[model samples]
Target chain A: MAEGKFTQETVSMTDAQKKAQRSRNIIIALVLAAFVVLLYFGTQAKLGANILQRPL
Target chain B: MSVEAIETKSDDVLISSAMPGDYYRLMKPRVMYLVIFTAFVGMLLAPANINPLLGFIAILCISIGAGASGSLNMWYDADIDAVMDRTAKRPVPTGAVTPDQALSFGIILSVFSVITLGLMVNWLSAFLLAFTIFFYAVIYTMWLKRSTPQNIVIGGAAGAFPPMIGWAAMTGSVTIESIVLFAIIFLWTPPHFWALALFRLKDYENASVPMLPNVAGERSTRNQILGYAVLLALSGILPAVLGFASIYYGVFSAALGARFLWLSFKVWKNGSENEHYGFEKKLFGFSIFYLFAIFAALGTEAVIMRVIG
Candidate 1:
């Protein structure tokens, strides 16, 4: 068997850059969560109680 | 000596330093506010009752679509934005966000907003939203803005579509009442923007934007402002004339329209020779209040009528 070789690169980020990246990530996560909530509620409102009557 | 140092020495890695706030600013929150307000008014004035959740979704989609267009506009206009005092500090112009990032952000939001609206709401509203983004981004920002003095006049249609979209979201079709709402904004846009252009003549000239004041000269621009102002005043009272709004709203609209015309007259007569352009500034300020007041009056009347009935 041949041995596998791997290389990893690390880039340094400034404090400000890291903070900004963190803020962006948090916002993206929140937006995605909000979208999921909206989708669930929107489906409920749109389909009403009939949503539960679907056949398997 | 570490991996970071080795990577730094081998090649410079460019990481975006853009904060979330910078991304928000790229969306033109102020303009989005106006779009949301007008769209809300349209939804209220719509004859059909809307599901509250659906209505909220519709407004959100419309606002996101508008913001997407604003992002695209900022992306494409970054060069000119850098030259203009008013827009020099925008995210793209100030290096807080790159143009390519802004473009991708806009395209992604535009597609997302449109698709979500279509799937969640009605397709008609989604289509209108899609067209509005296309009009603002492609027609106005990319083409007409650099090419003609009539850019705002034609581009105004994109801004005017929100109320119609809102109405369509509720009713699933366009109607004369919604068209009247659209016409008010359409007519109101020229005078409002021209008032700003009159005061910012030098900025427009510096940017080589061919604003009416820059190309047709201030005199023509002032005359055109007055002309549009007159049309706007009549259009403001159209809801009453057409019997959609109550007499009280009509009287209120009339009074507001009179003030609009009076200010516009001052702007027209004062000419561009005034050192301060005070009348132009006043007109510009009042125009914002005028549109807001008109839409608010209509919305209030709608709510009152619904309550009374």
Candidate 2:
């Protein structure tokens, strides 16, 4: 993460980077699950053409 | 991806060595995650379902617009970003991406995303997309950020627009439901960022960015953090009380929200700012989870409602 001194978020080899990375991974997993869960809604019978219809 | 890589490499060098990471960095992926997640919730809660393909397209456009905003922000803030520890190594300031290139790239993608949404969803969503870009890059970054201490507090409306944008993409109209989502995030921003500002206080001071820590004493900032935290905590309960959410959503939101308040409480009472342990910093870290967890819960509730109700 360290880009050097001239930039923001000094990519210092600190413990913080490792932690932030782990947190980021967990977030990615959750978002993926949300995406899968959302997919279930798309397949519901009530969805129908309403899925394609623009709100008028 | 390759093109983005080339854009970051100086035109001064004949053959560019642009990496996908450069584009990722330029997109400000972290902010984009929150933007996309909130927008996803809005789409889920819409009165109608969007076709999965179109839904995907709508999300793509929103994400692209969000990326465009990041690029524009990076383009404009290269100077201040150079000074701040958090943003110094960004593609633009790091000489990885050229400013003019970023500007044009952002504008083009902004247009593309807005147009795509308009064509696939509705003009309302399209218009909102256009507005979000202008608000984030122009209003928040250009006008408010450096000029005021209340920057994130007020400028936060830009970030708050996501769920509304998502709702528009699906329903092509706005409603109290969407607006309430907007208000929740709107109110949530002050405390979220203020907590961040508390720990990164020195960064703002060094950048002369006029964040709350620079303008308000740590005491006043701490008080404000607590105040906003309480507001966020209360707002979390609204989905249930308004009869819009199930007991599950209510209980879960409240629980996560209370933890949020607890963290803010720590920052309020213990963020004396003179100590080295930096508990306020820890609160700031967890606060990201606080927001993400609640929003994720909202998304989960929507899915459950769809499946069972």
Candidate 3:
């Protein structure tokens, strides 16, 4: 029973570490994703004339 | 706990050091997503409506195949990835996965993806999938990468094959339009990559991969980037001229191409260390958007036509 508890504690610590790492990853990914979004929409907006074509 | 059990736990830690999520990171899932998205667009535009299930199967297989290639790349390049900040935390390099495990995982994924694609999609796409794996794994990784500075340029062919494979999956034959898609990516790769090579010169040099920056010097690399930018700009016009795409695509391609050319010119004209130009990051990031937008345009046009009909 004590050994089970011990392993449970260890696993919890590992899970905590994993959660911390995931948070870091999400932040970095969001920053990069934001940059990509800006570049994509910014360029599209710049090419407004071509993109706004209505079969002409 | 006994000593043996402790050892076993340590081994477990070594085998999966970074957790399951690391698997996605190591496989370069984002890159695979972009490749699959473009390939899907190609398939959708190919004058047919494939069963959505079958189309999904083909795309998933291609994605897995792309991931398999990435796993193998990480396995082989672990030493270099260990140091490069851009790729340092890959499963193998970070000790989440052993080299042997990664090798086996990659091999298994390779076989599984190809067989699944062949049985679910067309055999032609299956064959192309197999060739892409071989070209990247054996030709690029084993032979050319260490030996030539033109590694990425030649190896770019492996990546450039995806849209063609997608078209073949739908139509069972290659066409001028598909080949032109291949050509645009083929020409764009060097300039896109060389810009990053300029920024990360030391990491590549430390890894001894003989990238253009290390072997040919920044000047030659920049000039090459400029040359490729010009070629890419020209190739961008072919889709519209050939009547495969609309004038809208042509206009957008021209704008994107002009911007790409300007970035290349900046990379060529300014010194590498100069932050005034903001050349390096702009080219690296914009190149990705350039390919995606072009492919996205193709997909959107096809959707518009389908709706109108």
- Highest-scoring model, lDDT: 1
User: Positional deviation of B168 in candidate 3, in angstroms?
Assistant: 0.8
True contacts kept of each: 0.45, 0.00, 0.00
Per-residue accuracy of model 3 over B136-247 as CA lDDT, tens digit each: 8888887888899999999998888888889888887888988998898889788888888888888888888889989989889988999999999999888899998899
TM-score of chain A of 2: 0.54
Which has the greatest TM-score?
Answer: 1
> Residue-wise lDDT of candidate 1 within B1-309, one digit each (tens)?
776566555543357889899989999999999999999999988888978998999999999999999999999999999999999999998888988989999999999999999988999999999999999999999999999999999999999999999999999999999999999999999999999998898999899998998899989998999999999999999999999898899999999999999999999999967979999999999999999999999999999888987
Error of 2 at B251 (Å): 1.6
- Per-candidate clash tally: 0, 15, 1
Cα error, candidate 2, residue B155 (Å)? 1.5
For model 3, the stretches where C-alpha displacement exceeds 4 angstroms are A1-56, B1-18, B272-277
Scored against the native two-chain complex, candidate 3 gets a DockQ of 0.03
* Cα lDDT of model 1 by residue, A1-56, tens digit: 01112235645566777788899999999999999999999989888899899798
Candidate 2 per-residue lDDT, tens place, B131-208, comes to 989999998999999999899988888888889999988887898888888888888888878877877878889888
Docking class of 3: incorrect
Ranking by TM-score: 1, 3, 2
Clashing pairs in 1: none
- Sorted into a CAPRI-style docking class, model 2 comes out as incorrect
